[model samples]
Target: MVIMKKMWKNNQARRSVSQLLMAVVAILLLGYLSSFVYFRLDLTADKRYTLSEPTRSLLKDLDKQVFIRVYLEGDMPIGLKRMRRSIKEMLDEMRVVAGSRLAYDFVNPSEEKDARLRQEFHNSLMEKGLKPVDVVESKQEGGTDTRRVFPGVIIHYGSKNIAVNLLSNNPVLSSEENLNQSLQALEYKLMHAISSLVADTVKKVAFVEGHGELGYLDVLDITDELARYYEVYRGFIDTQSPNLDEYAVVIVARPTGKFTEEEKFILDQYIMNGGKVLWLIDAVTVNRDSLSTGETTLALVNETNLEDMLFRYGARVNPVLFKDLQCALIPVNTAPAGEQPRFVPAPWPYYPLLAPRKDHPITRNLNFIKAEYSGTIDTVGTSQAVRKTVLLVSSRYARLVRVPSFISLRQIDEKPVQEEYNQSFQTVSLLMEGKFQSVFTHRMTGKYALPPGKTFREQSLPTAMIVVADGDLIRNEVRGRGSNPHPLPLGYDRYMQQTFGNKDFLMNAVNYLTDDAGLMPLRVRELRLLLLDRARIMESGTFWKTCNLVAPVLLVVLFGVLVNIIRKRKYGRPEKFG
Candidate 1:
């Protein structure tokens, strides 16, 4: 009987061990299979956690490692802390798609105890093109403390490194709104940096130089900025055998002279072949230098002769100047001459500060774009094949000055009625996309002779173009002596000491036009920020505090009691065996 009991216990022990081993084996097999499959659920209402398709594809196709150094670290404000968290989460998601190829680190450059070391670090970062932002923190018992922080990232891939500014600041937006816009743009900025660094071949862009367009010196600032991404070329289009097809984008910046029929035909053919163009044409011409003479200058319509071509493409640059109440200030000489003149900043109605459209990707979250004698743009044609979007527009308090009107600096002294400046939302810049009908379609065979092996395309392939009614949008201000002039940054007003959004607006326009992978659409992603009313919060602070502190615990206790009661009813019954 003792042997039988011992044998039975041993058998039971063996059965238990066998079952345990099988269970372990099954768990291991399940885990191994799961390693090959990937799945995730994003519960965010705005789909903030979800990676864009372009981003995912870019990550998955990475052949080599991409190292990122994020400088948004250490002690920071709640806003910055949240930005850091979002960046980390984005990088984590990227890593999943890119596997071990995408690596990143959060670095705190201000952590150095040595002042000299910290200064050197900051200088190095600045040299690497990372702009530092001054962060001011209000102390509980003191005034405030200021610290310099770089909310930027450096992306390294292969033999290249590109710096990306993560903070998108708009002077028009509130601090919170600016931070939210920056957060919204985080993905595009990072992806753009990555794409720029990883590009295998450099794309080509050309600035059409003939026909009295803005000279090389005038556009030097934007050219310098664009050279980072494209192999920029400055030359006249060869109308005899137009080789414009070699370039991805062509810029006609403020062409003052008329384009010959042959040249226009060549340009039209280029557009028909899916070529992109940025037309910064001035409809009304006014010599701004004449304003310095203290005399009125006649602002006449500029005759480029490309109006017909542009009209066929879906927009018209009207020969009317826009005057906005919200405009840049110029330092007017309020004092008499000979003595030191007191230059006071006065609003120059001719120099309208345009607001970017919030609905479009090209202008979303952009700051005010300064314009000098800019004209209005009117969308034409009712073609379903063409889509036009107003990218920049004047404010509600705007007025239109028809061509042949005189512009004088003395007008700044005149206090105009606000009711007179009631022309609202006048379009100044437009983006046109889709298949464009060639201006020389039927005329090519009849009037213009086509080269051998060349065929006239009546309709264009899918393409895009931007039309700005102001030529000065692409022109930069020059400083220094007359013999050796140096270009100031584009959209910079020396008198006001402010930088506008002309450079960014133009860059984004070109980027959108040349982008083949549709990455520019990523700029439209928006994350809405829900903020509490500060006044209400302060007024009902105790009531809210009590609810936040006690509500969860009370709910937990209620749930426990309900579960216990259900359990008692479910299993606390006397069982009768059959």
Candidate 2:
């Protein structure tokens, strides 16, 4: 019996040693194989952590180191803290794909002890285009305190740097909703800034300026914004020697004068060569300056002579003014015009706050677009080859007024009947794409010939164009008078002192039209907004806390007890009566 026990102990020891050796060898093999064949699984319902194919491609192709400094650190509200966490996680994922090409750090500007030095640093950041957001916090013992936070990032690639603002401050949306929207756009915003800096060639964009369009001062803001990603040029469409095949995109912003046949032909031929155009044309005209001096202005048809061309391409800007009950406010005197002219903001139906469509990538997650004297667009053709997407639409309570009608400030005091404002979802902005048919294809093209050495084709290569019925959509407000006037930000309302999404809308439109790497699709990503139930936490707080603290200890104890019983049953039992 003693010899048998000793032999059994020796066999058990050898078995233990052999099992340990096998486990070690298996782990070593796994570690070696993992280096060559790697994969990660995102079990999240929305696949939030999975990077889009375009983003992965862009990161993999990055040749230089891209460093990012995010200034959304320090103590902030719960919502902002969540956003910061998301930013960190996103950067971590990017690093995994980009390896050494991407790096990022979180910085707190408020950590500086010296007040003057911090202020200087803040000013420098502002100069770099990082806007600050004020956070109002309730004090523990007293009233409240206000802190300024810059929720933005500066990306450095090669020798170029660009700033991207992470927060979307839309007053129309609640704080939570805005944060969710901002998170949805986080990927696109970062990728767009990086792509612009790392691009090998900067494309040229021409702002067509021949026909009394908004001049340098009027479009100064958009021009400056486009300069970050494109080479901007302003010139006339030469009627004598018509040629515009060089520009990638031609923008006709708020042209008040009509286009000549030769100029239109030049644009049509340019489109035939797979060029892009953004046309902000006013089908109906109302003199807003005239209304400033008086209470009323006559709305008339503004003829730019490009109607036939647009119809052939796929859309028509109607000669009617769109008025919506859901509109912006304008200041008007209500005290009989004599009591010191007490001005108060009132709803101006003609100045509609256009709603952006969420389905398209160009307008996804965008704020309300502010427009003045905007008209509706109608898609006019049955061409299956062309696809027309509506980017902006009026509210359900929209009313259309024909040209030759008087627009009076008295309309604000006059109550609108509910029945009269029943038109729903009138198209304000449209995007048309495909092989566009030339306007002069069926007409006399002998008079409209391209410059020598250039070819004119009736059918275009795959092309795209955006038509915004409101011309003033791209025009910025001016603060001062005459030559010294300062241009305000585009889509900024002087009365409300709020900036709308006109800039973002235009930027996305241009990017979508010119995108070659499929990056715009990243803008449509949606993340699940998971929120804790405060009421449930308050009601069952103690029960859940106790379970969390005690359950794991209980589970470990039960597991150990079960293991001991199994061991005893297997090893402590008397030898079977052999």
Candidate 3:
């Protein structure tokens, strides 16, 4: 009987041991499977997801397959590493919205050892029209050693290619904020370009000629840049017989001649018919750009009748000149190049450094717009679809001197002349938005508008942009020397190489204006920086070093000890000294 009982006990112990081993195997298998599943472990607090409506809509509605190729090398700079990491993190966030429509690959150019494969890769990228980026690395040695590294990206779908300019694939624009902004833009820009490439459904914009409007050649930079996205046309709007539907947007550039009532009626009807316009009007334009800095005092030169139409729109263009606290740097008349460079400190004449309103989209992320002989505009009677926002304003410390004046360069003008001219900020550039109730709204109640008898009707606002400050600093005043000014950069010419962020500002303007709020917001992206300043660490070196090295270990040790004590008291034993 004893032998039988021992046998039974032995059998039961063996069965229990076998079951425990099986349970361990099952747990291991379960852990392995779960580890392979998609689990995001984001270390950045800022990277925690925040869904934007526009991004989600674009991703969900994307029809074509967008294949993205991320070119990377095994070795990279630290800054570049940080940037790439940020890019990847942003890409992961994008995946949430992009779903499977956005396909990506991190290509290791070094992986393919075969000569044919390498050649094929290069040819494929080129065939897709992706720009080849040549990266050069110099070894720190007696003899400089150089290596060619290609780091870039290619976005493509159904033969349409949009190569994003990856300037210095290093961390040049590498911040989390920048990465997010770029990614947000990626789908929208690519879609817009691909749509353009596949379908030639281009929108038309015009630069008005005649009436002393800055000649088309003067704004070559603007036109050229705009050419990438618009069918840019250069012409004049005849107030007598205007073709309002000729273009989606119209540019009434610096006009010197006053419009007749008939001309004013045509413009009014155009606005009522939903015509988009960009008005660059001048008030007191002084040509004393060079001499004004000399012994010349302020001179007021009237270009021509500019205020009639603006006044009709509920704002009067100031005929009086403005000397604002916000100013720009102009080249003082210089001696011969070889002579001691003598550039006198001269205030840019009426070239008010426009302070952009942060609330608006067109002026967001803009540093400053340099304009000469610019004027201020004020709202008159309220018009429909006529919500005007201040695009640019002068500093509070500004004063206006009337026309027929000369800039007295040597007039004790160290400080601005204190004048009681409203003592409030006056707007130089104004943005008109919403469905503007046309001046012809009362007239155009019936059918399409006709001449002699006017038609007034309210119209929907086009994705439009305008700046009613008459100056060409932002315009490419200079054209190519060989031919008529082709365009300074964006199919429009600038007068000079002032590098005043004009092109960038204009592009951002177009982007913002054309951008759908549910697609992508072109407003500026801001990033808050917390610098881990080395000086602070160096000052409290010992304590910092200890905190960096031993603090985490100490925390873990304390936690583990507390856990053990709790476990012992709760389940194992009573804490008795004995």
**Candidate of highest TM-score:** 2
Candidate topping lDDT: 2
Which pairs of residues have clashing backbones in candidate 1? none
lDDT of 3 by residue, 224-304 (tens): 667766788877556545676757677777776666556656666666656667777766655554454355544455554
Instruction: List residue ranges in candidate 3 displaced over 4 A.
Output: 1-48, 69-80, 105-154, 163-200, 238-246, 258-266, 288-306, 334-349, 382-385, 408-424, 441-465, 477-498, 520-527, 533-538, 555-578
Model 1: lDDT to the true structure:
0.88
Scored by Cα lDDT, where does model 2 land? 0.89
TM-score of 1: 0.87
> What's the TM-score of every candidate structure?
0.87, 0.91, 0.71
- Model 1 over residues 15-122: C-alpha lDDT tens digits? 868999999999999999988766669998999889899999998888899999999999888888888998998888888899999999999989999999999999
Locate the minimum summed-lDDT window of 10 residues in model 3.
Answer: 489-498
lDDT of 2 by residue, 1-578 (tens): 76776677678768868999999999999999998753678999988888888899999999989999999899899989999999998898888999989999999978888999989999999999899998999999999998889999999998899999999888788788889888888888899888888899888899998788998898999998988789999999886786677787899998888898888898988898899999999988888777775468999999999999999999999999978998999887777654577778988999999999987899987889999999999999899889999999999999888889998888787998878999889999999989999887867777766867877688999989999999899999888858789999999897888899999999999999899888898888888777778899999999999999999999999999999998677556655324
In angstroms, give how far residue 216 of model 2 lies from its true place: 2.0
Candidate 2 matches the true fold with a TM-score of: 0.91
Model 3 lDDT, full chain set: 0.59
Candidate no. 3 TM-score: 0.71
